[model samples]
Target: MSSIEGRHPDRNLINMPMKQNLVKEKHDASLHLISRDFETCIDVCQKALHVLSSTVDLQQASDHQEEMEEFIVIIVQAYAELDRWQEVLPCITQHYSGIENVSPNVLKVCLLLHAKVQEFSTCSALYNIWTSSREGREVNDSDLEMLLDIYVTQTLLQAGKSSQITEVVQSSQLSQDTKERLIATYSELVRETQLAEETASTTALPDLAHPQNIVDRVVAKGLRALRMMLMWIWSVRPRLSTRTLYSLGGLATLLIIATQGFDTSNRTLEILGNLMEHFIRSKR
Candidate 1:
């Protein structure tokens, strides 16, 4: 082809940008986000989105996937800062599909923004994906805290759902570490509740934990949590044969100590005694 757009047309067309011009063009909007100039960044990001949509077809989304995801991240973050929460999910969802792998930062942006607005449905979907997918599963501990805050605080999980928690522990794609943490948190909450009930007349329990802060002595979650703790302990007990119980003897011993660490009421003392007896029997 004559008069072609050949490689040597402009002296072997240099890809190396000479000035800071190219760097500025690529990162100026990102710098806006760093400075918390979200409004300016939002404009730049939206323009980038428009250009991407106009230039690429659905079939070519993979071609621009990395750059497009970066644009989506900036857009969502800007929206989050603006408190335009309702718009953030759709913005991420449109570009995010099954095959596309998003960065952890993008998952975080989606999860937190959705949680902030109490968008439980969307948050659940995002969380299920985050928990299940290997692509974005290695979450930071702080990010895990943020996720639990949304689950325990915002999402309305009925406290006594042993079946539900069991299902999650067994079937979930969450790592063993996450499952163990969840159970540990639940147990610690139970321990705290017992301690709080023992001293509640002098001190106040927090509202989110239960209604002991106010006139009511108990609420739905509190009762459910209390009952569920007992049920879980019992449910685990039946599986203990001589060998099994002996295997768990150390933990049983620990449990007796842990149970005693709370209130020392007659009922609690009875439990502690029973646990002590059980641990002794298991030793033989």
Candidate 2:
């Protein structure tokens, strides 16, 4: 009984000073955080962490785990406020899972930080967890708008990665506002991509029959435009209207007249023959 009692008191004596120092350190750290002295807060936390490491007692470490976790949360906020997003990633990945109940505000900031760094996948997972957390916080318009804007600004606007956001759109329980914004974004992208495709597949031609186009373009861009028109007709023959077919007759005649001595006889004849075949098929 005497020996056991002696050991317990000795252990308490050894652990007690560290406990007092930890409390003081945390108090100072809290003050630093409140004052926006972020770097100093981190420094105080690190110092306390070193003390915990030196103790190396599993029970002691477990007892103070909550304190350390709080410190890490502050550090994460500090990093985010400083715009050191890359650093926030490792801190979150390391400390986040160990936390039993995460603060919604902090998690929201994490999501936003991931977005700032273009970490789309990471941002998505954090967003799902934050919005779906057991805390039962209602997702406000600002939250929904933030996620949508993240996709629009980072993914679609920058890399044209609309396909990447499809899974999020389908899986997430979005608000009507978000859905509407997504619809608008989708329309914008479709208009843009369609325009790009048209530009690539056809030469931009004003009406060749127009007096101005005939003047400005006939010599400068006429032959190029005619070849594009012929290719366009050939490509869309199955869906061609009679008017478009007649339109092609004009293009074919122009092409033959323009390129007669340009060493393109075989190809020109092939195009003319294809047009004749199409006319015969239409008549039949």
What are the runs in model 2 whose C-alpha is more than 4 Å off? Answer: 1-39, 44-74, 80-90, 93-104, 128-142, 189-284
User: Whole-model lDDT for model 2 versus the true structure?
Assistant: 0.59
Pairs of colliding residues, candidate 1: none
Identify the leading candidate in terms of TM-score: 1
Off by over 4 Å in 1: 1-26, 34-37, 50-70, 97-101, 129-166, 174-178, 189-284
| TM-score: model 1 vs. ground truth | 0.44
Residues 131-220, model 2: lDDT tens digits: 556334455656555655555555554555666555555444566566766767776875787788799767656467456445434433
Candidate 1: tens digits of C-alpha lDDT, residues 47-77: 6655554443332333354556677777787
The window of 10 residues in a row where model 1 has the poorest summed lDDT is: 10-19
Clashes of 2: 0
